[model samples]
Target chain A: MTPQAQVVEVRAGRTRRRGRLVAAAMAAPAVLVVCAVYAYPALSTLAYSVSKIDLSPRFRIEGFVWLRNFINQLTDAHFWQATWITVYFGVMLCLLTVVLSFLIALLLNKTFFGRGLLRVTVLLPWAVPPVASGVLWVQMFHAEFGFLNGLIRAFGGEGGIIWLGGSTIALHSVLVTEVWRWIPFATLFILAGLQIVPKSVREAAAIDGAGPWRGFRHVTFPLMLPVVVPVVIFLFVWAMKVFDTIFVLTRGGPTRGTTTLNFLTYRQGFVQFDFGNAAATAYLLSALTVVAIAGLGWMLSRSRRLAGM
Target chain B: MVGTSLARRLKRVLMYAAAVLVLIVTAFPLYGIILTSIQTEPDIRSRDVAFVPTYIETEHYQRIFDEASGIPVAESMVNSLVVALATAFLTVAIAVPAAYALHRMSVPGRRVILGGFAAIYVLPTLLFVLPLFIAVVQLGLYDTYIGLVLPYTAFTLPFMVWIMGSFVRAIPVEVEEMARIDGAGLRQLMFRIIIPLLRPGIFAGLLLGFILAWVEFLTPLLFTSDLSILTVTLGLFRSTMDIAIGQLAAATVITALPVILITAIFQRNISEVVTAGVER
Candidate 1:
């Protein structure tokens, strides 16, 4: 190698190193947009929880009120009521959606006539935006002209039942709408898990003493559980953060009967302009979601290995 | 052996029946909307619910175009489309390069980066809403298109990067090294060679990203106030406040059309994309 070629090569290598440094520098800014716009706000939320942030022209920030908002949130009847409602709603929604979706998946997994068309239709409600689904349900629940009222009256019943009016039925109404919208997602995930379950396992099970129920119980259901556990965690966290369906359908209403934690956060932040309490409420919700999902992920991974073995 | 085989066939027949029943229940509401959208007022109002369409009325759809999505509908739909499209474009743009970097270079802490991204992925939907809302208002971009789209890209990016990142890593590292030896720069290798090879992954990622933006209920609803961002979801929202069944059902079908058609076209692949999304 000549000295000139060596110098040129050395310069090229140095520039390449410099180029990586430049890209690395740019990396923070590029991704800082993500962190700033997304994660930073959540961090800011934590700060707001401990500090008092009043929304005036200046939106004053007073320091450190450790767990005061949480105490107040816990003390507030509305907050506790919202928690029970949320937990109840989440449990019911997850269980029903999982069972329904699995049954639906079982039916659709085989080769049959018009399977393709049924698959398309199944994706329809899931595909629509949740806000849209909420709105459609509200319309369907309408009297004198709603499709649902029409169905009820057609079945030889007096059809003037108002589903969303009272506080008792109001929350249940929202639950129904959520189940309607979310069941398809549950079905789709289980269906995905079903795809890889070996056909021969079932055949072998059937070749011996097992019946259909026993075959699935021993061979397929256990294999499907690893995937289903993660999905349940997802749906649980998702249901906790559900705001659109509630906002569109009930607006925490008749008397704040159906308010979840997320709905309360929105109410405090924007509707009532209580930024400090709102941010605090959000952090509470976020903390719960994080712990639940992390815990579920850990458990699922452990079970995956055990199941695989 | 023959009797046992007959029993197996019978069980399979029962399975098909169960699937059909589930489909009928699921399809009825949707069928109601499409039928309601096309029915005359009296036909819809008649005591009998007709499964068949007697007459086709294009009035509400025509009104959507003719009257210019009057009074907030047009603005909401346009806002939604703008937000969704921008989200799809930006997410793909940023994810491809970053994913390429992670895929190609010996980046330190790759597993940590991957895990951090996964942890962030499952953060609940509106947990960031309050702080972000304040930030948007603070930045003086509240109610602006960019305000919504920028955050949206943030939400979907991690999921995209992780899914597409793992997929890009799945491609053999040798191909890129060969391209590098043959006088291809990083840009050329990414655009000319790697991206084409990643078309399936990119296509699937883009689909999920677009759907995330389109079907997103909470974020857009929170941010936009003054200028009506015309959206089908917003149209359904009106149904909550008022009956206007004809108009709402029409809007419902309109909102649901793109999603239904797209899912139908890619039914085989969507489950994989969404299921893979769960890993992150």
Candidate 2:
């Protein structure tokens, strides 16, 4: 190689090195912030889960009792109940929101008068804060003067129903508020998916003497699964962690009916001031969440690949 | 032909019917909240539910703003504004450079960094807020604007970075190359060329950050005890117990207004982002 060619090659190498350095410099701030926020807290929580935290003598950490906190919480009946409630709430929320939103998305996909206005209104619930939505729904569910009862009375049914009073019913009422808030997200996402399902595919199904229902079942729905599955997972994860609506609506309830694992963790930490138990519960909840996501994600990907998607 | 036409007509009618039903279900609660706020306390408590106010009342609104009532609605709004705005600006400032670097440059571990951001974004806040609360206290940042601002930034950063990454990638690399060829420095290329093109993403990120911080309940509830620094959610939480229905409804409406307006104005951009985000 000529000396001048070697010089040009060396200059190119230095420039590339400078570019990498600049990139690192640019990414430094975000990397630092993420570490301070996520890493520190995560490590401390792990430590706290292993150690007993006592507040009586001014917030001191007592001797390490490894695995004791976890064992105690696992054995506790209330912890199991909270776990059951979280799973139940998340599954129901996932099912109802995905189904309802898919139907709405289909409707919205069709060209119709006032479609634009409907689209904007669909986003309203998403914008409303969960705490505020709780406030709104709590008023709506009021036994005597609530609009729901008034509507029931006007329609010749008995007016007074304690919509949020019963232990069984309050969780369902909180479920409704969450569904209301989540539908916007699911609906919008599914609608976008619907648009991507080619017109030719539908027409081909029709040409094969398939009815609308048959076409949807075979062609449209299967194509939509890729979008729907991810949305379902995202909604489920969010539903599992819902706190604000519960905080405002029921405070985990009339009984422990709505005391989800997330709420239970809050109660143990803040209300009961048992940081050790709370931290342990939090870790368990996080582990459950990570496992659920990974498991569902893996299963879905396998199914998709098998189906040749 | 007639049979097919009639069926088509029926289909159209059903579609519109479903659309209207969707609209009512989505919009009714919001309307109810606004109506409840404007209705008199007596009317709200009365058994007769009037969808429209027989008597329009603004007293609930006035009382919320009146500091003499001791609710601190006004004070907390200011606090929320400060925290949310700080979070928005800080998030954008940090996220933009990082996104540009990650997308535009030959960054090592780019995929890992992207995946890490996505993972952190998906993790429940419950997992972090406990330890975060303790750390905030330990660092002596508790009960201050910075305390909430810092955490809010961290929460919003991952999202902003992803969104802004797409925005950065949308700009052709040749644009920056040409600018460099013209002897423009990296700073000049970014500020003069890329930043101008990134306006829409910046706006979306800022709006989203502001909304997230404004609506946040958990962090502020745990971090601060000072009434002056209490956020809107915490203020509303306190008032929910003793406050009148009309007054509480007013507060809810007040809390929701800015978010509603932002969502309405940026519906298209946000919809694109949402679909892009999930479809990723």
Candidate 3:
């Protein structure tokens, strides 16, 4: 080639490279922030998990114990209990949230009078901060002065329920508050899922003489699975990590009945200042969450594949 | 034909009934909170509580603002606003360029960075909160707006980047190419061509970041002990015992109202952004 052409091509290459450099420069602030925030914490958590944190004047890593904290946490009965509770809570929360929100989404998806108003109303609960929801529910679940008890009494039943008092009962109450708080967001997701379901598909199902239930089961629900699967996994992960509502409503109380692994991590690390144990629990919870999500995703996709969807 | 019409009517009735039920279940607690906030303390504590207020009173709201009540409602609200606004602004500013780079430019390790961010997004704050807390202390950022603002920005950054990246990707690359051909530098292309096209996503990210930072309880609870720096959510927890039920309800309403108002006003955009990736 001519020397001028070669020089022009070389300049273009340099410009391209310079453009890339500038783009990278633009991304540097965000990349640095995330690394400092997430990457650093992640590494520090790993380090703290293996070492003993001595709280003398301030938080100082004394030395490495290498898996003793993990061993201690794994062997602790409370850890096992928290594990069981976390699993139960996450599973139950996923089930209730998906089912209820799906039903609500179905209702909201239909063309009806005041549909827009109802949508706004349903969406409002999600906007209420979890702490506020916790406080709201705490009042509602109050045995004497609560709206729930008042309703029960108004309906001719003997009133005092001690909703947040008993171990199992308190967990259930927390579950209710969580479900209440979660339904709106979940409904939003499902409604979005429902939106993508085409009219012609439903018409085809109807023309094929499929009843409403069959149409929903075979056509619409299947169509929603793509969205539903991820939503379920999201809800499950969120449930396992629920700290604020539980912290507000029960404080993992009524005899540690509601102490999920997340709360346990908080209790161990912050309340007891057992930073090592807390880090271990957090890591374990992360591992369990990852496994559960992976397993659930596998199961969902496998089932879909087997079903030939 | 009559029977078919009857069946259709029944279906409509059932649908409306179900819709109302959904509304009631979703909205009743909110209504009850508002009701409780307005009711007299004696009425609230009464075992035979009326769903409708027996005596409507603004005393609870008054007490929240009242200095003797010791709630610091106004100050905490201001703190939350400042932190949330700062977080929202910072998150969008950082996310937009990062998103453009990821979506538009061939940055090295782009896939890995995006993947890491997606991973971080799915993982709970529990995974990072412990060490983050320690780091904040060591950096001498504890109990300060910068401390809360920085973490909140970080927490919201990955999600904002992803959302804004989706927006950036939606804009035709041909537009940027044309600008480049016109001798537009990368900055000019981004500022003039890209950011204008990314307006919807920017608004979504800003509003979402604000809401996330506003509602955040754990970060403030863990990081700040100074009364002046206390966020509204943390303030709700602080006076949980000493505060009367009516006053607490007032605080709850005060804390919850802004988000509710935002949702009401921007329901379409907020929901669109929130459910962005969910649709097939």
Give one digit per residue, the lDDT tens place, for model 2 in A1-309.
899999999999999999999999999899889988987877888888999898775677897998999999999999999999899999999999999999999888889999999999998899998789989998888999998897788888898999888778999999999999999999999998888778898899999999989999888887778778888888878987899999988899888989998999899899998988988998898888888889779867975775467
Q: Top model by DockQ, which number? A: 3
Model 1, residue A235: what's the lDDT? Answer: 81
Report the CAPRI category for model 2.
medium
Quote fnat for model 3: 0.75
- Runs in model 2 deviating more than 4 A are A303-309
Q: What are the chain A TM-scores of the candidates, in order?
A: 0.88, 0.96, 0.95
- Superposition-based RMSD of candidate 3 using all C-alpha atoms, in angstroms: 1.7
Estimated TM-score for each candidate: 0.89, 0.97, 0.97
lDDT of 2 by residue, B1-280 (tens): 9999999999999998999999999998999989999988888988878877667899999988997876899889999999999999999999999999999998888898889898886666767887887778889999998888999899888888998998887889888889999999889988899999999889988998899999988888888899989888888888889659989999999999999999999999889987776556
Pairs of residues clashing in candidate 3: none
Taken over the whole model, the C-alpha lDDT of each candidate is 0.75, 0.89, 0.89
Between candidates 1 and 3, the one scoring higher on DockQ is 3
